[model samples]
Target: MSDFLQTRVGAALKDAALAAVITLLLASIMVGLRTKTEQGGLVIVGQWGLVAWMVGVVFVGRLAMSLLIWRGNNPVANAMNAMLPKQDTVSKIGKLVGPLLLLFAVTLPFYGNRYVIDMGILVLTYIMLGWGLNIVVGLAGLLDLGYVAFYAVGAYSYALFAQYFDLSFWVCLPLAGILAAFWGMILGFPVLRLRGDYLAIVTLAFGEIIRVVLLNWYEFTGGPDGISRIPRPSFFGLEFTRKNGFADFFGLDYSSMHRIIFLFYLILILALITNFVTMRLRKLPIGRAWEALREDEIACRSLGINTTNTKLTAFALGAMFGGFAGAFFATRQGFISPESFTFMESAIILAIVVLGGLGSQLGVVIASLVMIGGFEVFRDLEDLRMLVFGLLMVGIMIWKPRGIVSSRAPSVFLKEKKSVSGDLVAEGEG
Candidate 1:
């Protein structure tokens, strides 16, 4: 036992020593470079900031090595390293956390300022869009680059219907969803046999076609001028406009802030619904069929799963959600234009899904927050903002090629306890 302990400790110390030496060499090179590259006629060592940074790096490296060597022999440290929360406990915590998050989202606007509320709404909107795309790309393994086309369809559908028929937002909303779903099925048909890059290219082309059509079709779509003065959502025959609505009804001074808050909660509710529905679907037989098809389409067919129906359903459902988001966007902005639905929009949506783990809801939320929220936050930086954002994305991919979140599928089956490794047990016995 003493021999084994000594061997492990010695090996750890050797590795740590090697790592420290490499680190020290790198630090020295950096210091040398800094010394050679004079700034403001000052030497490298003369720069207090640079010297302090280099010294701190060396000190930290040595400290880390010492800690590793010390901990190598400690039983308590070994046990702490091996410790992990039980699966049941993790699941319970997730169950609790999800609802609490939803509640926070719902009520955030009531307490937050107008700017914060607006940002929250934007985040939730993207979160919904990300989750919707997740269903097609993540669960169904369908690469849809033309998703923004469906969004455009929904927005335009609402705009046209409202303009021509004088319909309410509530009516236009579902109509837009249905129209988008129809378009989704149409897009899905030709790409049924396609996979990977080919599917991506085809979808890309489809999205471009939609945008081109909207650009050229002036009479119906209003072309470059776009549609404006589109109606905002109304509640119980009361319009949200400042002139005559809730503000006066409640005897409070009217402001756009209230409308912003209302929209925030409206989208929050929509996002929650989207999340709930997708989660429920994943547990159902149809959802399982999608997952199996994603894993292996041929095998899914061999198992008697209807590949055509599964594919269509995934496309339709994803498009429907995109449509819902589009309609909301149209109403929220009170405008529609060809520029709103572009290839860039599709790319950003895809990035959200990919950067988030493919099938993770929480990951989608985080990714949307980071991507969309970060973009908005960095808007003031202009060109530099995009450069930095691109670099940040590159860094994240290099660090986590799979995704920021690794686990995609929810663990449906009961987790069995893992047995100790036979080799480890044998070593212990010896």
Candidate 2:
């Protein structure tokens, strides 16, 4: 028995040593790849290279320890194995409902105050935009740098319709979505085969094309001055304006603040609907196909997934959401401008998705809040605000390289657990 134990220990040590050596080698390679010589003769490190090296080292170290424990017949391996989360942690409905309810609970009271309501509306707008972008970036795994084009399409669709036909906000909303979706399909068809950085560049160019068209199409889009005095949303037969608002119609005191609050909640509901629909779609077969496609497009094609339809659907869906947000924005602001749907807007929305963490709804929400909220807060700072914002983003990236809300791996077969009802351990275990 003693000799057997010694042999097992010796084997474990050998395995551990091999793993450690391999880990170091990989780390060295990463460092070599990431290291850059500056013009000033200073050594600079690439972010990706540094992240890979650190992660590789940690992974290797963990593997070596595991190997050592296994070879030594150490009972601690059982505990370590148990510490790992189950693969099916997403099956519980409570996991989905709890966080959502919490969000609503925390945000509901702000509806009473005009400033708070406006902020809420802005947050919801970004949330809708982020979710829309998520369909392209998260579900479809298409990197779109020109997502603002769809937004521009939607906004302009509303503005044009309202300006030409005297259409109401409600009437233009669906039309805007339809138009945006149509344009998304148009954009998607041309770049169906493109992926990664190439796709991003093409999308960026497409966005520029759309913006240039808006700029040149002066008679229709109102040129750089944009369309103004676009109507706000009305309830039943009552407009939200001070004279004909619901309060006045109902013989109650009237305030423009009330109208703003109403609009806020309206957009909030719309955003919630958008989020709900997206989450439900994710659980459907199409959603599964999207995940598969995201993981490996080639494998998805091999599995008989219709990549073309998948790509088109993603674009259309994403554009539809953008259209919704755009229409709401036009109504809320009482104006529409090309400046509202620029490349910078696209970059900001994309940044929200990337910074929030790809494929994470909650992450997008938090990221939007941070990015947009920060922007609102920094409005007073003027020129220096942008610099500070960029620094904040850099800091966040350095601290949490994956994102603010990092992408979570999907559960295979496990039931979902609510964070509120169960302890984190229990949630993972179940």
Candidate 3:
């Protein structure tokens, strides 16, 4: 017992020291840079006191966590385990909760403040992006870091057509998706022979290529200035104008919110379509081929699957959904810019898929809410927001390394259904 106590104390001190070092590395720059001063000629001013305070906090907190929460008989772990629902209960809760959440979403505009409604639209946008990327990265086991290229394609497709052709948003929407899918196929065919890091690098290059082209092609893409005044989407034959429009047709007072509400539902329907198509496809032969291709390409070839076609289809479908979301974004914002489609956007979408637990639709939804919505909640915190975000992510990784929902339900189960451990699946091989 004496030896065990010594070990725990030693472990606590070790963790505290490690935390202090990391805190110094991360917080030193942040705290040191917090001072604001007007200067034509700059002076290097740093807040050493703030840095010291941050390091002290980290050391104490880490030591306490290591000793009381991480070591043997951890109360935090015990409490969490106790609070967690049984495996069987999860499905029951989902069944009961899914519809409730949907109903809340559908009715949110009526009851929610404008700010809340706006946040809802933003969250749903990322959710759509996450679901789209889930197809390529999660279902098909492709490592695509340039998914946002297709998003830009879709946006540009809509913006260009609407600009030159005097086309309605409805007309441009499908065309955008088709164009993006074509680009997806183009990118897909060339990268079919590559896998793992090579595939990721190729995709990343493709994204940069698209962005650079847009940046240089000033006449065609408006260069860095971006396309503006892109028409907002309207209800069929009914604009949401203040007079003689949707509000007038319905005999309701014209509020700016009508347009916002319409965009919300439009994206919602599109997201649902993406979800429905993905779910239905999962039951199809092509979807099974994707799962097989993900697990082991060699085994997949041995089983006579056309790996090339499978990969292309996954890319095409994923790009199609991304295009749809991009078009919606263009319509909602009434603008399209090369700046809007960056590598960071792709990173966030991919992170959503990985953090959500690959190929789990519900997990993607939950992860989107937590990541995107949670980030929005921290907007007031400014620089501190990122610090909190990093810590929260670290905590989650420590607690559930596989993700929030790590256990996957088998695509085809025998008489007894069982949850497959995430460890059993290869990366992106959901």
Best by lDDT: 3
Location of the lowest summed lDDT over 10 successive residues in candidate 3: 35-44
Candidate 2 residue lDDT tens string, 1-430: 6565467555555555566566557666665446567787867564556655565666666566656555335667777667756634533542585487547735665544666667777887898899899878877788888988888888888878988999988889999999999999988898867877788899999999998888888988888888998877888768766676688888888877767777777887788788888888888888878766776777888989998899889889999999888888888887877778788999999999888877778778878888997789788999999899889899988866666655354534468632221111110000
- In model 1, state the lDDT of residue 137: 88
- RMSD of every prediction: 7.9, 9.8, 3.7
Please, what are the lDDT tens digits per residue for candidate 1 over residues 1-430?
A: 6574377555555555666567556656665345545667756553445645665666666556555534555665566556856655755675686678777787787688888888888888889889889889888888888889998999999998989899999999899999999999998887867887788888889999999998899998899889998888986677766787978888889887878888887888788888989999998998887777777787878888889889899989999999999999999989889998989989998899888767778878878888988989888998999899889889978866655554544336568534222122110000
Kindly give the number of clashing pairs for every candidate: 0, 6, 0
Model 1, residue 249: C-alpha shift (Å):
3.0
Candidates 2 and 3 compared by lDDT, better number:
3
Report every candidate's CA lDDT: 0.79, 0.77, 0.87
Better of 1 and 2 by TM-score: 1
- Any runs in candidate 2 off by more than 4 Å, and if so which? 1-112, 409-430
